[model samples]
Target chain A: MTGSLVVVGLGPGNPDQMTPEAAAAVGSAEDFFGYFPYLDRLSLRPNQRRHASDNREELARAREALAMAAEGGKVCVVSGGDPGVFAMAAAVCEAIEDGPEQWRGIDISVVPGITAMLAVAARVGAPLGHDFCAISLSTNLKPWEIIEKRLIAAAEAGFVMAFYNPISKARPHQLSEALDLLRRHLPPDVPVVFGRAAGRPDEVIRTVALKDASADMADMATCIIVGSCETRTIERDGKSPLVYSPRSYRGGSI
Target chain B: MTGSLVVVGLGPGNPDQMTPEAAAAVGSAEDFFGYFPYLDRLSLRPNQRRHASDNREELARAREALAMAAEGGKVCVVSGGDPGVFAMAAAVCEAIEDGPEQWRGIDISVVPGITAMLAVAARVGAPLGHDFCAISLSTNLKPWEIIEKRLIAAAEAGFVMAFYNPISKARPHQLSEALDLLRRHLPPDVPVVFGRAAGRPDEVIRTVALKDASADMADMATCIIVGSCETRTIERDGKSPLVYSPRSYRGGSI
Candidate 1:
């Protein structure tokens, strides 16, 4: 039996957001590997074996999956959002590059899913309607200086921004520092969206002005979106107000 | 009779990539509105009415959909890829903000889909594994100057960049200019992916160095990904080499 491995994204917290391709990939796998919460979200067949690891064990988990696939075991590595975005796909690729040469022959593919920022954008109207940037505030992999520089550049270029891994118990100060960097370039009234556990039953989405935004609004599970200068909010009678950036730009010289 | 409008994405050309929520939204709609090509891709139910318009009629189509929904019709406005990204959700919101007050009362929601960039990233490995920015190369709505400025900022900040609508028959020079600007800050061998009609039957994905990248490599259907300095290409025995950015950054004062 020739083994294969596929990295599939579960897509936020909603099964409805998962693609048919992703579902099919998951259904066919004999072994599943992922972070504990994500692994717990799946219902496995009686014969299937699941390996749930901590979040910090991405590289090790990826190596294990590759080894399983090499030994002719069908393996599926899962991620909460699109596997290619700060998830298992890259980790798998890194494993392939550094592992035994024979591992390269295994069939590997990435199945995309609806990412957190886009799901949050849809729920709060289309704040990402125009040009945008997605940056992760986690300092575990990249340095804090690089994150700060990217924030300043994104704001200066007038791109709507989505911040992933915005806040965590260990890295509490990063989101606030990032927000302060944005405040230097963006207006005080710029709209900011704090979306916690988007697409889940316990999801909470709050829209606040840049001046009123606080770091306490987010946690590791939250995704935050800061709108460009063109983003606007439309008040409604009994529903949440709509937030969207207009498709056209008029401020920059034509 | 209550009216409702749901903007749904078909998700990068592949039917398998379409989410269950998007499929459900389209299934229940009495009327469907979208650009001609996207509308052509769908087979409507016998009772459903399909309104296919030219690509340039987004706002007008949005208004018509809103009007129909306000008149107690279940309307679905469709776009390829996620509706919230450079698509119909923002147009519908803009229509609501500018249209009569009654339009705002119509139930409106956006269903997200696997966007083009993510689909392309999955196919070519995770070059978007780190911080990234997405910009549209089309100069019809925004000035070329702003696009130029954003490109410079993105390059300076060491972002892997995704350029949507990279080239078209009407505007061919913009992509080359964008590439030339990147050539200044990015290394000569930085990987550039030209993914045309990604996830479709005739999908084509080509990875080249920045030094060899050209304007004619893409058209409107193409999504171009320019790798950050950290992106690496791993050679395989008999398969396409994988391109991905390491999760950790080693440059810029780590």
Candidate 2:
């Protein structure tokens, strides 16, 4: 008997943001594997078994899930945001590449969901309306120098940036370092948004200019978006300002 | 009476991919405004009305939608993918910024949905697992020279790139020009994916090396992803290759 493995995203901590395809995958799977918090988001039937692991145990979790699938069990892997973006999909693919041959033969498919950056971008206006890039602030899987280089390049190219995993107790200094580097390249008035737990009940979305933005405004749950020069804030008489990046750029044909 | 305007995404031609929040917004709104094809995706109630227009009239559509909202009518503006990303949200924000003062007082919220690039990435593998940038190849709102500069900067930054509106009959040569510019900066063997009508019944996804990626491979319906140097393709025995950019970088601590 041949079994299958499906990977799906929960979409930025809100059930309403999850896609129907992901919900269907969750409903059909007999076993679920994921980081503990992601797996907690599911209300599985009694027949479904849960295999929750730590945040850094992606590869091991992938291997175990693949083995279960190879054993003719319907398995699913869950991720917090869009599975393809710095999540379980890449880990599962890497495991299939290096694991036993049978693992490659198992049926595998991925369902997309709303990523954190997109959720955060929506809460604020459309700071990502034009060209944009997403970078992870954590250096656990990449070097600080590479991150710095990318920041400079993104600024020079006039691309708005979204930063995931912006801060944690372990990597307290990186976010500040990144912001300092960006301050040198981008204008002081550039809008920087700190969106924590976007789409959740206790969500916090704050916008500050580059000169006033500090590392303390963010946490591990926050997704930060730094707007390009073209980004603007519209102030209403009685409401908070709406921030957005205009579609048309300078020297455009329009 | 205070009216609200909500802009939402239909998510790459699939009803299953549309978020519950977006669906709720659509259901609550009395009137819908969008381009003709995007409006065609919706099935509204008998009381609801759709105001469809041509593609290029974004500002005019935004103004009309905002006017209705300002006059105490529930309004919704729909876009194909995530509205914040090269879609209707920016146009709506632009209209609000330039229109009458009361337009700012209307309640406005944006609901996120599955973007085309994320859907295409899930179908193959996680090509956007690492740092990535998205650029629109259409010159209707931006200059060709700006696109070229951003392309060069994205390549030098070691970023996987996603191209939106890559080609059209009017802009036939832009994609080729963009690829030729990347050929100078990126490796020839880097993977280039053309994902046409992703999540739709007639979807076609093709992967080729940068050297083989031609303009004809893409159309306005396609979302093209260019892998970074770190991206790899794993070949299965009888199945198609899975493409992914590993989460860890070359100089990563892991």
Candidate 3:
């Protein structure tokens, strides 16, 4: 007999944010697999096996999760934000396909959660209703050159942006360089919101101009949202927003 | 008697996607106010006052809702997504501040649901992690020029995006124009995902290059999630983008 696997999204960083579907999967799981940091938030049963680790042993950690699921454990692989969105769902999927049994008859369900984009978008105003793209400044996978090419193209096209892995200890200047590329084509006062530790304690969401935001940020659990040329920020409620665009309405009495 | 207002998010477009907290709020409310489209989803009490309307009468209908709560009704103002994130929470807050004795003692609580951003991100890989922004393409409140600026700035700064109102009847050409702007800044091959009726029936989530996505998409219910330059479209087990950026180290015994 084979057990099922469910990849649940535990929200950004709050227990209350877990969906009923996600919470149920977590409560009923025989084993939980996730990153060391993200896994600590769950209140797993005593018998549940939690395979968590630091950033050093990613491959080994991913493999162990499959072994548990293969052994007929109803494993709940959790990820901060949504599992499929730049999180652990793919790793789990990869392991299942590569395993000896091909994970046949194993129910794999991907339950959704609040990702960083929405959390940050809510912190700011509604800036995500157009043609936009998300980019990672982390150069671990591809060359920085390729990243640069993509950034340049996105900038020229005027796509709004959600940035991930933007700045870390090692890659300190990537964010700045990317900003410089934007400055070339876009105006200096475009809306850039830095959402630090969104939905977590010490959460800080502040909107600033493109130039100002570039200088004021550090790399500790942050998501950045940059707007287009048309983005505007008015002090409607005494808040600092350099918003990109407003709603174009005629008949609607908003 | 003083009445309270609870703004609960219904999480994406699926009932299963609703959070426990959100469900509890809706389940316990004596009166409900929302767009007519979502009334069928929530099971209100027989006597529950469910005020629904289309877009043309949003504010007037909402004002009437305020008057209802002003007269002391335990109201649950519901929206498709998070209430505070571009939904009716702000209007409720404004009504609370603007009205006289009837609104003075009313309490307002905001409960978040899975917004379109989260749903789109989940459909794609994790591009919304680091720095991101969501912008509405519909120019109902602001002008198109402002949106273009925000798009330029956000894209230039390497932000990932989730586009709400990416396409609608009135804004058909605008979406393509927005896509063109994004394509100019980003690579032609940058993956942009269109989430049509996410979590609802006829839900279509397809990740294509920015160049290819601009054509053939126009729906009011559509949400577009565009990947960062680093975001890839992998065909894993014949699946679309089962993963995204910020690859954590999976280092545990397998």
Candidate 4:
């Protein structure tokens, strides 16, 4: 039996986003390894061996999946969103690469999921329609200077930004500092979208000016969205939503 | 029987991303209405009526889906990614609101789909691990200054960004100009990730300094991601790939 590894994205929340291809992989899997909540998102069949854990247990989870794949059993390793983004797809790749050569025959592929940024963008209007970028605030691999330099470059380029992992318990001022950097080059009226737990029951999406978002938010679950120099917010139907459209237009049909 | 609208996201490409709930939604859909490519993503039973149209035929697609719901059928308005993000979810809502109250009785709920941003993020790293924003570049509905202002703000605040609809045949310089503005605030070394045809074959995920990206890219099928100060690229086994962790300490674990 030729075992395969399918890494799936569970999406921001809810299951409607799952595609037919994603479902087929899950249904065919003999072993399912994923984050706790992600595994819970599925109702398993009888033959499936599920490996569920938190961040601390990722090592254990990856090992089990690798072993299963090595044994020639189809395995599904899942992530919350697209596995390629911030999830475990990379880890799986690494694990396979480091594992025994017998595992080389396993087919490893990634199934995409919806990231929180797309959900936030929709809730707040077309805030991400133009030139924009996304960054993570985690200081783990990169020096602060590198991130700072990128921020400056993005700001100068006038791209909208989607921020993931903005604030944990320890990194409080990083976001504030980021806001400060943006203020130097961007205009004061720019809109910032604060999306908290998007697609969940407690989801919150608010579009505020650049200056106000820093004061209004400070949480780990939050996904901060800073618009470009041209982004704006309007009270459409009494809903204050941020919108982004290109400036130079020839008025062609879309 | 009470009818409902369960909008689904098809992920970027292939199947592994489908959650159980999302799969069930599609499986149970009595009628599916969406673009042709979106419909091609699913395997529907023969009983389901698929109203697939050209990409530009948004109104016809919405009208057909509305008719199905009006007939008291469990209908789904499908899209490639998150239906809410520049897809058919909003249009379905609008159709229900504008058409008749009879459609209102049909339970109107949104099943959030997996968005492309997360897919791009996973591929490139955690460019969006912090506060960030998204801005659309389309000029169909609103003005361009709005996008500009939002871009400026995102840049000034040093938020990561996701740029959708970045460039098309008619609007090439919009992304370039936006990049120029971002350069004013963001450091020259800030990382930028450009994703084209994300999740689909021919997908491109690459990170470079913001300055280099402006001149290098200008395509419609691309999703641009800009990193904050915290994002970094690391070489694993002599292969350098972008990696963004939430914090420096957390990064140590990876």
Candidate 4 residue lDDT tens string, B69-98: 767788887777566556666566555545
B48-152: candidate 2 lDDT, tens digit per residue = 999999998989999999999998999999999899999889999999999888999999999998999999999898999899999999999888889998999
> Lowest lDDT 10-mer window, candidate 1 chain B?
B245-254
Candidate 4 segments whose C-alpha is farther than 4 A from its true place: A56-60, A240-242, A245-254, B1-254
Interface RMSD of each: 0.8, 0.8, 6.6, 7.2
Candidate 3 ranges with C-alpha deviation above 4 Å:
A1-5, A12-16, A27-29, A36-47, A55-60, A63-74, A84-109, A115-254, B94-105, B237-243, B246-254
lDDT of 4 by residue, A101-201 (tens): 65556666666666677667656545654556667765544556656766776766665667776765566777888888878867787888888867678
lDDT of 4 at A168: 55
Query: Model 4's CAPRI class?
Result: incorrect
Candidate scoring better on DockQ of 2 and 4: 2
Best by lDDT: 2
Question: Candidate 1 at residue A118, lDDT?
Answer: 92
lDDT: the better of candidates 2 and 4: 2
TM-score, model 3 to reference: 0.70
What's the TM-score of every candidate structure?
0.97, 0.98, 0.70, 0.61
Ranking by DockQ: 2, 1, 3, 4
